[model samples]
Target: MKYLTIFSLLAFITLFSSSCDNDFNINDDWADITVVYGLLDPAADTNWIRVQRAYLGEAAASASYGEPDSVYYDTTAISVYLEAYSRGADGSLGTPVNTIFLKPDFTSRKLDDGIYSTDDFRLYRTTETIEEDKTYKLVVEKSNAKHPEASSITEIVGIQQSSNSGFRFVLPNPNVIAARTFNGNLKWYQSDQAEIYEVDVYFYYKEVNRQTGAVEHLVQKLDYTTIEGAQIPADPFETIDVDGSPNNIYTLLASNLPELKPNTLRFFKSFTVIIWAGGEDLAKYIDLNRPTEGVNNSKPEFPDIENGTGLFSSRTSIMLDEVAMSQQMATTYYLSSTLCEKGFAIVTSGDTCYCERIPGIGPERVCD
Candidate 1:
């Protein structure tokens, strides 16, 4: 069986540029495909929709995309809007609670070897929160005669709460940096309707100004090296266990902190863990993107948008905030030998660090 190509199939719910327009066109193609991509998260403060047209023609001989107009759309030719609706008692659609007009925003990114270019894109965004239990519809209209208007619907999924749903740090002595190494378990209950889960931890710290005694509580979001691409099981009682080790947490912090100025000493604050649960649409999209094991290597069909391409899905997130650090973590990890070698000023304390004793005082510096 030949693989059915869906534009933006590999980009998840976001438009990460699917390569439908290669320079060389080996096959004859005359159809202009309308591609749309968006993922709705109720926890987010804003949402964005990306629209693009698939180009089919003889590929250019040169590597360069000669002109900007070849890829992007004329802003005046496109119109986008998002309509929100709440469900009724009988499971029917109610009147739209709000209608948001999306504005056109052009963005660009730098590629490898200093190559700068803009994508064939017209993005529409709104600063409205997509609350749980409400359904959303995205409508895209175009002035072009050939491309038909498109629409997609997504029902926002609520989060599943767990009684003991948080990361439990296993620092035997919170005061020692060496012992402060992570030896704990991050746990969360599975959502019955969610197929995917993402676990993220943000490390909080403080950066103080030496001259004026000003302070800033900086946060470092830790990327999961081992906890990525995790899925929630069908059994809701099965808790997801993210094995946390000292190396897992500290290695990430050490690599990211040096950029903040290795020479400057910063005190470690608390950490927060964020858990995200994805809706059914997200699960279908994930399964469709996976490589087939057969000789055909064909992709599965998983488009949710009606009269267009790509997914419109919902996700909910919960954050465990203001988590405190143990004493061992403060003395060792905060001002450890590794950090000291990198020019972080040595902090002198009288039994307890000044920040801990006074609460939110930040890091203590030399001569203060």
Candidate 2:
């Protein structure tokens, strides 16, 4: 599965270019810099890592980026693997568990057209199940003796649980009424080894074709919030809340939903919440790479991988589905002046209320 951390590699290139002045040399001696990017997740059946070399020459870096040979190393030139270690009760690494070797994966997924070479793109992957109770160390070995090996270690983000109650919505439930005025809170049990958290809220609905009588289910996502530098609590039962305002949901729907169509009828359904937690190394990497402001904009480099200029971390996600809306909130979609014109309909207690405009009358609300 594709992970969001993959974009960090692109951001790294952008940041490097912006930091360079016009006087900087474009044709400097090539440095044997290996770029490593990986995110381990215990929930995934497989994990993949991207390993590439930084190139420099007479040509502009952008010009060479699209060339397969310029950015990618031959498959046989490098070896990648992970060494598992037992994590002790005191949070210290114990004896080695097992080593998992990764093979170059050319299929499974395709690369999008970009500045990077998409023709020969590849990723190293392993199907071995990742365990949450252990720590994983990534090791990248190069056949070229001149380049040093790149390595980094990370612990899984969340603890293993039998139930799906690890993450939950604490406020604005039973129905999200007056979302603009509703204070929202998303709570989750403190996940082990998690340093940063991100929450996403999705609004689901159905659109019926006025002519064909066919229905299409659709969903719109709103990035609720991100919580950084979170500390694991002493009590496992203790929870952490990510603050948010539901009013944004209304605004998001109003702005993003397609323009009202005369041949379409829209009905609001339910909401889903997804939470993501990142390991300490991943959190630190993001923190260090964030855009700087003010007169002094210089930032320190954050290459968590040893003998390389990239990151190897861990992340996991949890989802809560089908959170129902309150009856009043459902009614508001059809009655509210701001949303009624958007062709919203409400269905509650076996009754349906559709808001629409009549040619002779100004506007009309019909119930069936």
Candidate 3:
């Protein structure tokens, strides 16, 4: 198994540096070996019990998810995560070094089970210079298939030059550069104190079709203890410039989303992104009425592969600001154009490994 993780990480860096104070520490506890002798928690069915917190990257936001009515808002995905670490030296788990992966815009990269949190372990984000108290470590791993591989549930917080909770943020959280690539651009991650809040973005187009693999998404009913009273927005916040500024980017309107009738080139490629940082003074604005921008533009059911069979996909919702350190406020949603390779066998592309075969083959490996 990869030379047993390189000989147990070279016998733990040759027995903890061999001499430096002849010391040894990193036993946040739990380690019995299974992947050839790992640590943290490893009884070895695969691993279980995940969901931890403790993070505070401050602020940065965005959102988008169409049709709050007529059904479609599950926001699916979010099984395990909280692997942030700043120091723990060896307690294993939680090792991104500086750490930061909160994800917003509804968490679209799969793993959005609502920002995930079982409890404790959350150094989530914090590193301007790294001083404060030092400590650092928040690890929790489960879900490879999830069965009981155990290990990873360690927390050792510290660092508070100015921290009331875990503090750190940033990831592909701002992604939406362009799904089908028409008029797109939505990026977030700029928080000094989060100053101004009044951001709301939502776009939708699900139920495409790729011959009929069957698909239709978006039913995120709204939970997490009512999501901070259903999304802040009483008005009184405003600090997110994007710097390159211009308009922020908004364009879509087939009569402002006539239930999404695109001409199909891939107009909406099964999408999702619902963000409302602090909410915008709520008079009730979730794309106003919703269809996702449009004035002269056009493409909903349009072009979907000439207009049929694509398997549909979409989700993006972000309402950040729990400040980590633990839980109480978290929601993630992100799932971009994934035919995942329509069951694998006839075709799958994105540069191979969509995987399936092995029935007889010597090795053609062929699969788009």
Candidate 4:
């Protein structure tokens, strides 16, 4: 009887051990989620390069999807994130400075069935002025209840100066209106459409008062378009005499007059011909794998004064996105590079000087 008791006790201990080993909870229908990521850079071939794949799964639900007699998966959720940054010295992916949150507008961002879709295409914009020369990286991540992993960023984007003024001269005449300095003739030829947009030369310049010694600044920029409304047509360009719809160039000569010092004050020191490219033109380099519109979309690539690749060089083929590219109607240099290279000279038919500073005769200044 004692021997029988010992055997029974040993069996009981074995049963307890087996029960304890079954501590793991069975999960049902747990599987890795699918996601796709890509990159777009204007400098490169202008196409979105697919980075890699990632999966998210729970530890308890380690088994593949479609398990028989398995416990139901309580978690039904997923998420994705794409990060962008400049490479640090170590090269192990520096701090993520710029990132793109690629979730549809007002929609649930859940990557199910492992079929994720997104064109990680994006054009970089510096909240703080992006220096003329700098490089940045773009990273993407996707996660879910079942699969939580990441992918490497094999792509890098660089910000390059679009143009070189060589010698960006401003109207030297002190009496010249601030705006007149920007007035210039604009001519362009494109296959999709041939039309003139704003003929204005955009630039960033610091202004310091000659009398008060107070420093000031004047900067204006916008992506341009010749698709009507965005700019004054060539017909109007002739009317401005400066030759562009934004007749503002001529107005610059007449706009608010600033104190004058021929040699002291400076205009357009770091001057770059800001080719105001509108979204229509910039669409050339956009990674269309994803959808973009209005302000949310990447701004179009505008023509500027950069050498070899300035607006004239890239006039035919514009940067659409990483996944797309286009060509200009004619590679032939159309815009007068000569005019862009040299500063504006307001020519009043008879006056020998490039421009004349007509003293303000507005009603506001008619006092004795």
Q: Report the backbone clash tally of model 4.
A: 44
lDDT of 2 by residue, 46-74 (tens): 99999988788886568887689777888
Winner by lDDT between candidate 3 and candidate 1:
1
Q: Which lDDT tens digits does candidate 3 get at residues 91-146?
A: 44343645423221322123434433312221112222322232222222333334
Comparison by lDDT, 2 against 3, better one: 2
Model 3 segments more than 4 A misplaced: 1-136, 139-200, 203-239, 243-249, 252-368
By TM-score, the candidates rank as: 2, 1, 4, 3
What is the lDDT ranking, best to worst?
A: 2, 1, 4, 3
Q: Please list the C-alpha lDDT of all candidates, in the order they appear.
A: 0.61, 0.76, 0.27, 0.32
TM, every model? 0.60, 0.78, 0.17, 0.25
**How many residue pairs clash in each candidate at the backbone level?**
11, 4, 98, 44
Best by TM-score: 2
For candidate 3, report its TM-score: 0.17
Residue range 206-266, candidate 4, lDDT tens digits: 5555458777666544333233333433442122122343333324422333444442343
Clashing pairs in 2: 175-325, 175-326, 179-247, 180-247
After best superposition, candidate 1 residue 156: deviation in angstroms? 1.4
